[model samples]
Target: MSSDTKGALLDVVKGGVVSVTLFAAFLNLPVIGLPAAALTPFPALYFGLKRGNRAGIGLVLLAAVLVALAGGPEASVLYLGQSALLALALGWGVARGYSASRSIATAVLVTLGLAAAAAAVYSVASGVDLHERVVAGIRESISQALSLYEKRGIKGDELKPFRDALEQGGEVLSRLYPALLLIGQSIVAGINVMLLRRFANRLPAPIRIAPFNSFRNPDYLVWVAIAVGFSLLIDNNVVNAAALNVATVAGFLYFLQGLAIVRHYFETYSVPALLRYLFYAMLVMQAYLAIAVALLGLFDLWADFRRPRKPKNL
Candidate 1:
């Protein structure tokens, strides 16, 4: 066989192994498996970045076939529907040399749009309210968790109040689930973009992205937030919930912006890496501090917190 043919065959085999391992790890590991599972897209991304979209799609298809062979048609469809789609989106974006923010934004919007469509289809086919169904699922998962905890020796007074609080928390979460879903997808997209960018850097020509400190959303987003904020005053429950979810998503974006601002300042002042990490630890440990940072990000539109300072006269 020619060298080219051998190389192609090797690539196909490598893609298959990566896809199978990633999917199996995620399937078997459950709660702690997501990080490993996230790497499922790496093979596709590698081909896309190094070769092209054609190679990436080939990898995705191969992954679907492997998944189907191992787990059946249903599992294969699920993989194609979720993981494969995301991999293709990310890989295509990287292959095309899109900026990190734009790539992540595109992938996230695609994910949200696809999820919404699936929810609509499921609701129509099942003749059940999608929101309620989701809430029910969450409650069921919580019950399973509680059962596991009891099996592991958590019981009586210790477990009772914890269970009660968990039940209530689940309800609240379900209500805010739309926002949570968007946030979750955004995080996933961000991680994928970061990973892809890191990999791209090792290539002969790396993709360029705006510095983290300079990250900012378009001005129109603030107006959308304002509109959602106004909608919150309406008397309808449905409207209120919709507005709340939209606001929650906006707030999370602002939180990210705030973090960028924090990073910018740390870099500007030449803050020690250790101190910067400590500050981040505090943000994680203190809810109020985190909120304050997020608010700063939201207000940055008017505040221009990162504007350069003027030099003193001699």
Candidate 2:
């Protein structure tokens, strides 16, 4: 075989190996499992950007087959449908030289679309309410925990309050799960893109992504957020639920934009690196502060906090 052909084949092999390792880590790891799963697409993304799309897709198929053989049909489908497809979108975005914001948005949308499709398919096939199943699983877990606590001699009033709280929590979780899921999957895709940026220059095909600190969402999104907020006043369960989901997603997106604005000011003012780290820590630990940041982000659309003042002629 020609030297070029041999090198291409080796790349394919390498991509397959990386995919399998990451997928295995995703399946086997416990607390860190989601992060491990998020990395499953990186191999295919790298190869797709480096080689042609066709070759990259071929590598993904090979990886999926390997996963199916080793982990079973369910594993193969999950890896292919979720992680593999995400990687493909990321690779396609980078290869086409999309901006960092656009690329990340594309990846997040792809994740949401694939996730919705999978859930719909599963719901139809099983004839079960997915939300109810999830809530039931949560309740079961709470029940098991409470039982263990009871067995350990912590019954009576102490357990009663906790049990009530846990049940109530489960109900809230079921109601808000759709929003939670969207935020979670978006975060996963966003983080993966951030991580991938660090290695982009070292890959076979170098791609430069703008720093996340400079990211911004369009201003028109604010109107959608306002509409969703108004919908909350309506009494219809369907409208309220739909509004809740949209509002939650918009809130998180604006929070990110707010963060970027903070980063910009810190950079512009030459703020100390340590202080910037502390700022982020405070935002994460304080729920109210995070909400405040989101408000700042939304208001920034009109406030124009980041706009530079024009220099006056002397």
lDDT of 1 by residue, 1-314 (tens): 99855665577678767887888888889876688677776777666556556767777888888888898888887777666777777666655778777777787678668968987998899898977778889999899999999999999988998799889999789889888877876676677666766666665456765666787877788998999989999999999899988898888888888999999989888999999989989998999998998898989999899998899999
Candidate 2: count the clashes. Answer: 0
Off by more than 4 A, model 1: 1-9, 126-128, 148-157, 204-206
> Against the unseen true structure, what C-alpha lDDT does each candidate score?
0.79, 0.83
Q: Using Cα atoms with residue i matched to residue i, what is each candidate's TM-score against the true structure?
A: 0.88, 0.89
Task: Report the Cα lDDT for candidate 2.
Answer: 0.83
Predicted structure with the largest lDDT when compared to the true one: 2
Error of 1 at 95 (Å): 4.0
- Model 1: C-alpha RMSD to truth? 2.5
Each candidate's root-mean-square deviation in Å? 2.5, 2.5
